[model samples]
Target: MRDYDEITAFLGEWGPYQKSVFFFLSLSVFPNGFCGLSIVFVGDIPEHRCFIPGNLNLSEAWMNRTIPLEQDKDKLQYSKCRRYRLDVIKNLSEIFPDPDSVNISEVGQEPCLDGWVYSKEQYISTIVSEWDLVCNNEWKGPFAMSIFFIGVLTGSFISGQLSDRFGRKLILYGTMGVQSVFSVLQIFSPNWELFCLLNFFVGLGQISNYVAAFVLGSELLGKSTRAIFGILGVCISFAIGYMTLPFVAYFIRNWRILLFTLSLSGLIYIPMWWFVPESPRWLLVKGKAKEAEAIFRHIAKKNGVTPPEVFFTDLELEDLKAKSKQSSTIIDLFKSPNIRAITIVNFLLWMIITSIYNGLSLNTSNLHGDDYLNCFFAGAIEVPAYIASWIFIQRFPRRLSLTGILFLGGVVFFFIQLIPSNLSIIATVLVMIGKFAVSCALAMVYVYTVELYPTIVRNMGIGTSTMASRLGSIISPYIFYLGIYYEFLPFILIGCVLILAASLVLLLPETINIPLPEMIDQMQKFKFISRRDHMNLDPLYTHAATEEDNTVTQKTEEI
Candidate 1:
């Protein structure tokens, strides 16, 4: 029976219909770029110290000494949490009217009971400043970010199931609405607790819409266009959206105003539903052939082409229906040794990639130099990385390409710690390089993982791998929080993990020039074989040159 692509060949790739689907669907992902990482600026910690009220009649020098100097990282800096006792300073100020003559070194330090005074030079307000999520409460900032990823973890488990059952376009738009509405509601959150709660919903909707759009594009676009649409179309659009964040955030420093502005932009995408149709392939799979036919005709009309009088033959419809009913549970993933080994490798690879990618992205604020430029460059480098990955996947061996990139990223991160603190720009450049390597590695891993799994359990494999990624992302913020303990702790940790990830990639068989494994027994487990040898082992595979040669020899002898 003909597959959906073979049957729809008449529609042509890159026709007017394909172009519109690519454009609108890619645009749908634009908000996700910023939505996922908005916490970078939203929760930024500005320069702050314990507030010293103006009522203190102390001299300027004494007032400057209010925040006691202490060891932070490598140097002595004004303490963020502790201050010289103001009452003691007031008494000393009275005894010695000459502030220069007074010795207040031993005045004793206390916690900031008077709240904090945040520097407004960079940002007028952020979540950190608005609610004093600094010093002792600094953990809350990263915790909030983790809470968002936890919601993403929750969404990863259920969004795909919902999309499979309810259809792609429905879940796509439904989640988009969830993300935008919750973002707006977050602006009115009166306290940190409510804001964090809203963040969970925002994270849930964010990943749901992104994944739905991805699957929708994969199904709706034709074969020739799907590759580029997946790489350049969707990925670059997201990068463009990410690049826009720093600019928007640069202008609007206040967290509330930033959410308001970004939320309204998301709301504008709601009207896109009028033009975008549900995926025809999904409809056909669900036994709604009539509806799928109507959508095909609509697409043909939009592309200015004529559709065949009959869209789906009865046999083709039955094939699709049968395909839909064939299901594999998660247990199948662990049932076979080869399948289990491949699944385990993919899980680690995905977790490593996701955690480092998000860790570097969120840690951009901690990098030396302007926070906005660091973030902007971090996003900008990915566009090229994604494009390079698309090219690499087409030409390079999958295993080598992934290993090389991951290793390079790990080395780049390691080099960051060696750079002197004064050379902030150099360090930032290395971080960008690290980001580029991981972004490229991530793109390759997605394609490589798809090829490694058999068709029956492919969805389950990818879904489980995605869940691992969410867990990685969930832990990423906490890893970034380690920077507080030592400035380069996170980098050193990420570098070690990425290096381990690179080493692990050597265990997976290369998929380049190799046909996808269609059954559990066909997978390579942990070793590679000659293409002919690999194909000859799978009874279901007939595309091998050896098979064709054997057929020719038999036919000639018979003749």
Candidate 2:
């Protein structure tokens, strides 16, 4: 029986048909980039102070003096949550006949009873300013972001199963609609509670849409183009979308308007439904050989080639169906000692990479620099990181590259606290450097995990790793919250975790220029074979192992 790769080879690699699918599918990933990180601007906390009631008859000096002064490190600023007793100040001014003579420091203070006044210089409005989510309510800002990630966590688990049961195209369009609709509704949210509830559903659709596009592109594109399009193409598109957020937010300062604009961007993808097609490989596995053959002919016509009279024979279709019918459970992942160890290590590495990557992205606001520029730099840095990751994977050992990047990121985080407060620019640069390293590590671990797992349980392994990554994302926002108690606590914790994760990576075997394992038993026997030895292996023996492995790997890619 002929394989799908052979069929794709006949269709043509990187031809007009494949290029069109790759372009449109990459476009679908744009919205996810902004939607995931919109909270950095929407939940921003601007400079603010307690509002002084206008009814009190007082000079400008007394009015300004009503709010007590406090020291944030070396800089002195007005207290955000507290103010001096206005009535006591009024009486004291009358008795002393001078405002300056009465020491404001000795007077008692109280929380803002008349509400707070937010600064409009940086942001005209934000979720924090509009809802007074500062002071005791500050935790809610990160909580909302965490809620969004919780939805992503839930979506990651079920999207694969749904796409398998239905079809990739249907799920892609359906989830895109769901995500776009819920994101628009977020603008009309009456309160934070309602906004979080809607945000959860939006999260569910967000990752689901991304996964569908990713899998569909993998199945439709040719092998020569699949690695580039699946790994770098979608990521570069996402980075472009992410880089647009700071510029968009800079012009549209109002949080509601910014969200409305970001959410409306999803509408641009609505036209893609007509241009994209379902995976022909999936159709053949579902026993619809006729439908698969029709797509093949359409692709051949688009590529200006003629299709064979009998493209997919009945026996080949039956074999594809039989392979698809084979079932594997989660328990299978833990049945073997070597596979189990690899699974545990990969999960930990994913969790660490995700936590640091997202934690740095979300914490861009805390860095000592312009928030918009910091955010833009954060997004912009990843473009090169992705490119560098592609190069590193091609030229270096997977384990060494992964470990080196993680260690580099961890060291930067550890020393970030040592920078002098007066040199804020130096500190910001360090944070950006750390962002760059973690971004590369993030990209590397994804491909590395796929190479490590056997084809039989590849999808299961990646799915479980993604779930752990989402769990890390859920904890990331809260990591920034730790800064409130201790200025350097978050950095210290992230640094320690990353370094430990890097050390654990040394335990996994290298998989550079090696034939991917087809079974858990093969994976157990896998070792660090050099390129010279790998080349000397018998051609027939290597071909037999690789043939089955490639088929299973291709199917795994579609998930």
Candidate 3:
């Protein structure tokens, strides 16, 4: 029986239908880039000090001096959390008409009971300022971010199963609705607690829709298109979305308005349900051969080509049905030694990549520069990283590309610590470079992990890997907090982690110029199969769209 690609060759690789699917799907991912990392601005904590109420009847200079100056690193700055005893200050103001005459240093300090005053120079309003998530409650800001990621974790865990059970299009649009509706609800959030709760659903919808789009695109597009869609198309669209955050956040300084604006973008994708069809590959795997063939015929019609009346051979349809009935679960990922090794390595790599990526992205506020510009630079850097990743995946082996970029990222991170503290620009450049490399590695890891799993459990494997990454994201805010102990601690920690992750990449087998495995055993067999042997034994091995694909139309079916 002919393979799916062989049977579907009449539709053409870059047909009119494929182009539309690619365009719509890539556009759909644009929101994910910004929505995933909006916390940079949404949860921004600007320069703040105790709010000295006007009822205290204090002079301007004494009022300004109400908050005690505390030693921060090498310089003295106004304390963010503490202020001099208000009653004592009021009494002192009566005794010493001249504020300079009093011993301000001797005054005792207390927490800001009246609440805190946040600077509006950067943000007109953020969750931090709106909720007074400063001082003792400052941890709440990070906790809010973590709650969103926890929602991502939940989404990642269940999205695959949901997608597999329901059709991809159903889950894709359903989660898109989930993301859009909940995000709008957050605009009416009366308290931080409610906002965090709504944010969980936002995160749930966010990653679920993203993963759905990813899987749907992978299944809908042809072999070559899959790689490009996964690497350049989806990733670059996300990066573009990410870059928009700084621009939008720069204009709308209020977090609520910014979120409302970003959340509404998901609604634009509602029309995609009519344009994008269910994944034919998924339908075939689910034993809906007739439904899959109807989609193929529709694509052919759109592309102005006539498909064969008999789209799939009876034997091919039977093969699909047999495979469909053989269900695989998460337990199967660990049932075999080789598959288990792949699963474990994937989990660790995804965790490290996600934690480090999120750590670097989230810490932009701490970098020595303007937060908006820093964020813009952070998002802008991803474009080239993704472009470079596309080129690497096209030219180099998966393992080499992932390991090389990760090593380069790790080394650059280490150099960041060695830079002079005075050269903030140099340090910032290094951080961007580190972001570039890690961002590239992230793209590579996504493609690599996809290729590592067989079709039977591909969604499960990707979902579990994504779940592991959320664990990393859950702790990433704390990783950035490590900077409080030492300025370079986050970078130092990321560097060490990336170096180790790079070393681990060597253990996994490469998947370049190889057909996607159809079963878990086929993936495990990769370790023992030489490249030349792969081509000789499996005619479909050159599924990367080589010239051989034109002539090798039919081959013996085996796994």
Candidate 4:
């Protein structure tokens, strides 16, 4: 087998033990994965809050607005859409400014309320009429989630660029500082619009920590260790998000306090900035000769190895750049089809995985499973999924494993629909398995995605894939909110969507034995396969290579 690229030379220089600590330190980013789940876990949520208009008396308003929205045809549908938005925006009240809170009209578009955020939910557009939120008529929860992920989607890509252009350390520290400010606003927010606005900034600011932490972990471990380490890092984040969230929700019951406290705690991780090394690859990518040199020396010092100063010179970086050893951009992904295909498939998988993970996990509390044991049961499922991935990911083909798990997830969900409501425990267990499979699929996607494309655009591939996942995460809230009333339909549809996603995978290429190509040029040899076996790429290459050798032997015999 070919050795890992010398570009990964930083690993040999750092050795094994230091690798462990760096990997451990990287765990600090666990919070980023949990942030959305954290902010949404308010007690006031699930049980939608009654944010009655001050002008309308509570009992009278319930008679005119609440009951009417439920029973009347045209009015009920409009009111349900109105309530869903209000439900989401009011949840944003955790961060919105008081007195200045966004009124109903502002949520949809008109901004009837002076400070209200105009809601723009799209996923639940079909059944938004059934639910009820005591907030204004304009609140659009899915749209609100879209706004938050707008921050995440835009922020994640931007931070990735800035990290490559500047340095991961500086970007990480800067984002943490800004995020701290935004989190504080959760306490003071009087209006829903401002809350959405603040979440945008927070999403933008917090993603750097995620980018830098993963980069740091990959740099610390050897290439062989990369998959397991990265997957575990992801599992750690989800498990923590699942486990700790209920406590935070139970204690802080008030989403605002929970948000403020968590945001403020982010600053505590900032000091680790002193110990976290700048990424040697990033430094090499940017041509920062001296900075790269110093960081390399520190890593060598930690590993008890001698530093090579000769490689840190200006001429060396420029040479590395010429040799095609530097990093690249997202636009580079579309420069070739191999990267493009993997990227498209990976993006779709991410979208489905994130939506399923968020849709199921975030709302587990809503399933009448909110007690101590039930909550424990919920948090406990993610770990095994991680264990299962570690076993099957390498042993089985990506096509088989991915499709099987997702298809099974959907099937399980479908079965849950068949079980009666009285079978709560059995149904919850089955749904937990579904959630577990979805989370595992998400983690595996992270590992599989990295190797599917060429190196020039690896980060771009992952970033774009993540951008799609954020789209899924954004879409999930509406899916769950809409399904609350049409309970079986949502579960059944989520299953069907996941099944559709699994089918998409069946149509893509499998990367198991096909060595990860370092550039688009290497893909030329593998492109002529029949479409039926598109994903059956590994064996085709071996067979073709043997046939070529035999042809060469025939010419020799003729001569």
Candidate 2, 17-135: lDDT as tens digits:
88889999999998888776889999999999999888777778788789888888778899999999888988886777567887778999989988999999999989899899999
Instruction: Write the residue-wise lDDT of candidate 4 on 1-559 in tens digits.
Output: 1122453365373475555545455556656655655544432233222233554323332223321124431233333222324344435454543423434334432222322222322111111222322245323545555676778888777887787677777777777776678877755766566767887887777666676667766765666766666666646664765576666555554456667767655755666766676776666655565776676677677777775546544565567566444446666655444445656767888988888887776566556455534555566787788878877787987777988889889898889877776677788888888988887787777767765665655677788888888888777766766654676777888889889988877765566766565554333222333323322243212233457455543442332
Off by over 4 Å in 1: 73-75, 528-559
TM-score for all predictions?
A: 0.93, 0.93, 0.91, 0.75
lDDT of 1 by residue, 21-75 (tens): 8899999999988767899999999999899988987788778877788887669
Rank by TM-score (best first): 1, 2, 3, 4
Candidate 2 pairs with clashing backbones: none
In model 1, pairs of residues that clash are none
* Superior by TM-score: candidate 1 or candidate 3: 1
Off by over 4 Å in 3: 519-559
RMSD of each: 4.3, 5.2, 5.1, 10.3
The CA lDDT at 185 in model 1 is: 97
For residue 466, model 3's alpha carbon misses the true position, in angstroms, by: 1.5
